[model samples]
Target chain A: MSEWALEVEQLAKKFPGVQALRGVDLTIPRGVTVGLLGPNGSGKSTLMRILAGVQRPSAGEVRVLGRRPGRETKERVAYVPEVEHLYPWMDVDEALRFTAAVFLDFNPDRAEEMLALAGLDREARIGDLSKGYRARLKLVLAMARDAELVLLDEPLSGIDLISREKVLDGFLRGHRPGETTVVITTHLVREVEPLLDRVAFLKEGRVVLDGEAEALRAKRGCSIEDLYREVFA
Target chain B: MTWDFDRNRPIYLQIGEEICRRIVRGDLPPGARTPSVRELAAELRVNPNTVQRAYQELERNGVLFARRGQGSFVREDPALVGRLRQQIAAAAARRYWTEVAALGMSPEEARRLIAGVIHDDKSSLR
Candidate 1:
């Protein structure tokens, strides 16, 4: 196994009229949590989809868990897409069962733990659950897996305050140190700032700044929130 | 139970100082087991790695010690805690003075405020 969980060099992605990613290079060490931070349309989703092996990069080299992003890499990567697509008709328990049936890496014990942490009820249907609970459930599904790389795309976009707290709480509890590498994409920098070991500020399809979170704070003499503002806004 | 933080400083450093504050104040007595990084991180709503880094720093400073498989514990040395207490106080005093100065208080007014606090003027302290 390689120490690097993800390696990308000159990665590029073009979506018809829009060039979503433009020669972005990024490297993530195994077992580390990184924040891919930027406003919407900065190519955060494009890069994440490529890493998850759902979308291919047009140019440059990319690897997930030291392997090219493809079927094998997809097995190792747990992707919580920005727009989640779990069966809306299924109840919470059924959803967990479906996940277990699909992914060999799904851990029932971890699923139970995350369900309790997120305060989700097993009897409630996915459609009946509020947007916040649904968001939490999506995270639970991914975190329950023993995947080497977890990609969370905008998990905190439109949730209310208390719900957001529970979601953040789940993030704190669910991560397995030295086992899972998480890459979270969000514009809500301050909320996730403390959770990140590393952060890369993306802007207009390029990496504007990236480094160790704490080291960046010490060097820049400001929080990542402040830097995010200075970088993109 | 998230701890309050100053956004300008490093989070790990702030966390380390909070633990130090607890130790120096006897809230965490000598040899008392500190909360595991996972536990504290969850309580504080920060990353486990940040809490881990804080613990590592305290261990490096001899304020905390690791016991192989067990978690970190406050050192059993009275002098170590005493030194940290002083360090924390000095840092707080520096911060207090800087804040007062930033409020455009002259040295004489600042001295008067300090005197009022020393003389137990609770209202003035506020």
Candidate 2:
């Protein structure tokens, strides 16, 4: 069997005012973590949204598990948006139930385990919870599903360093091989590099560089941070 | 199992070297349960995935053994340790020579400078 779980070819998307993505080609394999990195307004989120089936592309082809993005793809793709989208009125249990209801493969036991591991109370409301708790809740919800592709759109954005560290550790450690393919989009290049099997650096709606993380480093003879600065500087 | 990580070398390579050093120095003897990935990660303040890469590299090179369910153990081959040390030294020497030449230093001057640095290591001798 081929390793590629999500493959995109000449994928392009445009907003009314801007061309968000232009001819973006990507091939992410199964069981590997990919880092989608870019600066502000680089269309990382747009590409992620397209993969998650939240947004439609202007042109080009995309295949998740060798099919178009739709109900089947959505079922296999677990997406957490960059912005906080959870309902403020929903309590922890309600949120879990809501997610469980949406995804057919959502594992309640896994959600319960993650909630305990993250030290989150089952009854706490999303609005009343702290930023750390909110982030943890989102992560738990995304990870609870046994999806083939888990797309985290800036999972650690706006969190404190301590909380970010904890969240990263939890997400990295809890992954089960062959069952999950996690793609994290972030500008925090240094913090996210270690967890990434491959990295794609986007700039101005185009993928300027893409390769295996270690191979990219070897090719440039520089750290990921140095390379990032060089590419986007 | 304490490791002071540095920024220059990659984390996984450093981990492989540290494990090799322990094996060579007899700190982690053959068949010893050389710290679990979680334990070493906590001690070194590094990601467990990075530590896992280090262990993977060692296993690939035959410097460590894993008996599934049971954790990784230091390899019993003394010759493997010697070979690894030599390979590392060769790479270091090549890097040093490349830098020395880039600095426009003659072979004699570079050798003398290197020897002088070694001579200045008073703490190691003591």
Candidate 3:
């Protein structure tokens, strides 16, 4: 309970021309569901990508489970990018086989359970599923791992109401207490507020608000959705 | 079992009071197990943490007791129902007084208004 699951200190990232991150600091304890809140292009994805080791930070430090966010952390962390990057030609079973071959912690049983829960057929090709189902399938793949941390970027976006609720339920059902840390980045604050333990409000490459969900709600006397509008408006 | 609470008050506290009231009214009889946190949260469309807090408070207040690996059940204290009824009555009086004062009604006028409303409500129900 006392262990620090992930930590970032003065983290910064630079693209070809834009500075996406500017000295951001965040600390997440184990077993917490953190909501990474921000508008589009507010460095939420860049921060997540950097922590996933898909992109290196231009400066500063990041530690996942007390190790650098590289091979060591990569083995223990599961990341779901916002975009559908899975090969359209690959079937669901083939994708899981490839993913299981890559991540040591990948649980085939858990993956199959999540797939079944998400109602995605293993025989169907990725290109055949609807965009919403495709996103859900990718999410299920990421969540099936017994990783220390799971980074999800906009897992609720682009889905109908009924499907969105089902997907959210699958995410929670896949996680066990003290076994996984989930960082969900989304603009749909109201939909995801209940699952959040801590919330970080990012605005223009900076985290302007970061704290426990209840404390933030008490301070503003408003829901997280209203707080976002007040801060970003 | 059905309520739409105002967000102005803390949700957990309201849930705790509502549960106690249910117990006092025999809606949840003594020894009856309370709903699981997930069940109540899903039913209320509220955070599970909020429901957990309410259940914790209920246990602490001696209104409920948890059996390990089983579930929380309404406490069988002999005096609990009477005690809770008094507390609810006191709370209602406090709210009524405060509201009447805010509306600029004198004590006598407030009392008369309360009597009139209760009488009208009873007659209408009959």
Q: Which of 1 and 2 is the better model by TM-score?
A: 1
Best by TM-score: 1
lDDT per residue for candidate 1 within A1-233, as digits (tens), equals 78899889999999889999999988989998999999988999999989988898889999789899898888778999989689899999999999898899998898899999899999999999999999999989989898888999999999888788888888777898778999999988888898899999899899989999989999999999999989877
Residue-level lDDT of model 3, residues A72-152, one tens digit each, is 788888999988789999999999999999999888888887888889898899999888788778788888889889999
lDDT of 3 by residue, B1-126 (tens): 335764434567778988888887889888899988766766665556667888999899898999998878988888888888899889999999999999999999999999999999999999
Model 2: CAPRI class = acceptable
Best by DockQ: 1
- Comparing 1 with 2 on DockQ, the higher-scoring candidate is 1
* Model 3 residue A190 distance off true place after TM-score fit, in angstroms: 1.3
Identify the runs in model 3 with alpha carbons over 4 angstroms from their true place: A107-113, B1-11, B14-18, B21-27, B41-50, B81-126
Error of 2 at B28 (Å): 3.6
Checking candidate 3 for backbone clashes, the offending pairs are none
TM-score of chain A of each: 0.98, 0.95, 0.95
What is candidate 3's fraction of native contacts? 0.08
